[model samples]
Target: MATSTPEELPSSAMTDEDYGAYRASAALWAGTSVLITDQQGKVLVQSVDYRDTRLLPGGAIDKGESPAHGAARELLEELGVHTVVDRGLAVDWVSADSSGAPAAMRFPGELIHVFDGGTWNDEQIAAIRLPESEITAVDFVAPARLPDLLSPADARRALAALRARINAAGTVLLENGHPIAPTSLDRAGILRTPRARHHFTFHTAPVPDTLALRQSWGWVFAPDGRILLLLEPDTGAPCLPGGTPEPHDHGDATTTLHREAIEEAAARIARTTYIGYLSDPAASCARARYAAVLTAVGAAPVDAATGRTYIRVLATPEQALQQFDWGPAAADQLAAVHQARHRLGIPRAAQQPVTELASPITW
Candidate 1:
């Protein structure tokens, strides 16, 4: 007996394909422009109310506009600046949002085309003519300080671009007729910088094992210059009133540090200054290694329970170091803290530690 073969489905019977086509038609397109310039080898930035910090000036590329043409037009409109495009700097695919979500909305992907524009002085800058509704302020900013002035991620990307330009130039001419080469600046893009990283890993080993440990520590300062030190209930060693970040800690490193300070010391920190990182000399089993610094913005309570006493006393750096025993990582941690403080121009207080007195705080 001959068996009949199964009949094939007709293309007209496919309903799923039609639905997929409909979804593709509903997708939207969006784009943004980022303008960069180097002044004396520093990056120039502008401020926008939409973001908490400053950013490069650029906006959406209108229909029928190439990214290069859009960048030149946007810069002129936003900052009244004009320049000759040197070359394409970079092209990045970024995701952004079109909904203007209360938080940043994500776009499916953005084609960011970066171009090189030779430096322009203030006199050479064209007249800026942006609508007040779109722009607020414009200014020049240093490249090394970009990390602090801009959001960390933006800073990192901008730094990469800025460094690329610096490398291409090979040497920067100072106003004093001095030609400074890239070698003058460290590979990390800092000049006249202290031996920060070396002091941590080589001199003071902050981590015992390499398991990526990030702890939050805050130094509370009074107007009189006295820093608040917490005597651990278990160790009696003098140290800053801060603790390890909790699993639920939300927000960035600074936010986590502030939250930790409030929880451990019962004091709220108002202001902060980023110090830098410290690590172990040898590779540790830990995965994370970073450090930061913060100066107290306002007065902290002497006793969280009573909420009554507030005293302002200053401690010298030496005194503060001597009085506090930082536990296992004390030496490395304190060194990082002091280094940050000095960089920020905070004067160390003068106080003597009585080595005979012993006490420790329990974690």
Candidate 2:
């Protein structure tokens, strides 16, 4: 057998122009079916053989077929999972190429239509026959853990959307049909309202002070895409490094967050990019919350108050979720942290599993 030298190889091997042109002529489309259980909120996923990566049950949409129809068909054919097609979840245009850029010789783009479908129980799911050529295994995954099972980008986008739905579903009513405002709640039947003619008279009397409550403040951020949380010494659960804002504090929430970072974690934050807020108003307290991206510049302090020496490093979101010690926050707090990270443009691969903070009664 004769081995060809680099210089002796045919020039045809050096160029992909022909292949590129052929790809350009092909019209490409894709679809993904998201099987969700109303009872458990778990999605059915399949593990692909190539990378042992998990993916939603789906495949390329055939010619002359709608994406939704394609998704339904693919689910039944690939996994033998029958579902009632409800509506489209997300319609994203992605590249068929790994670079996620437009193909040089193929169609301008590939459309990924995600359709939401009703879910199945463990027994029901166990009965399905998955296409062995593409799917290696199938399992039901909680919405919160979906990020760990799928590609970073796909997981982040999906999780963000799932959370938005959950938050919307958790809306509460206060009086008649009106929703309760974060800072105020009605005290008609449950608690008595205070009444006094003069301010001095009110001060003089031993008036019931059941209405007053303190608010919690904090800045939530993703450090280099990973969540930077502190283990509260008291609760031993993970929490964003923040505290109640003082009366004299200046600037916006971002500034307060910077101060909190220094105080709680002994880390210096160079800048903060705002994401959104969560309302935590209840019998115990009321808070106007804020979240952001916390960028670090240099060394971290050993101690916040003492200003002792400390080691500083950057970690991906996954690392933070696995390593950080959590404290008293609800299990849903982890999901909240992840939602904030998704909004900050952190890729899914960098995100860590947050301990989910429990939903408070106040909403």
Candidate 2 local accuracy as lDDT?
0.46
In model 2, what is the error at residue 358, expressed in angstroms?
Answer: 21
lDDT: worst 10-residue window of model 2:
183-192
lDDT of 1 by residue, 223-258 (tens): 333455444332233445455555676525556667
**What would the C-alpha RMSD of candidate 1 be, to one decimal place?**
21.0
Q: Which regions in candidate 2 have their CA more than 4 angstroms from the true location?
A: 1-28, 95-108, 164-363
Against the reference, the lDDT scores of all candidates come to: 0.47, 0.46
In Å, residue 96's CA in model 2 sits off its true spot by 6.0
- The TM-score, computed over Cα atoms with residue i paired to residue i, of candidate 2 is 0.38
Q: How well does each candidate superpose onto the true structure, as a TM-score?
A: 0.38, 0.38
Compute the lDDT of residue 295 as modeled in candidate 1. Answer: 38
Candidate 1, backbone clash total = 33
Model 1 regions more than 4 Å off: 1-35, 82-86, 96-106, 126-130, 169-363
Candidate 2 per-residue C-alpha lDDT over 12-48 given as tens digits, one digit per residue, 9 for 90 to 100? 6444554455544664555454545433455677788
What's model 2's lDDT at 174?
21
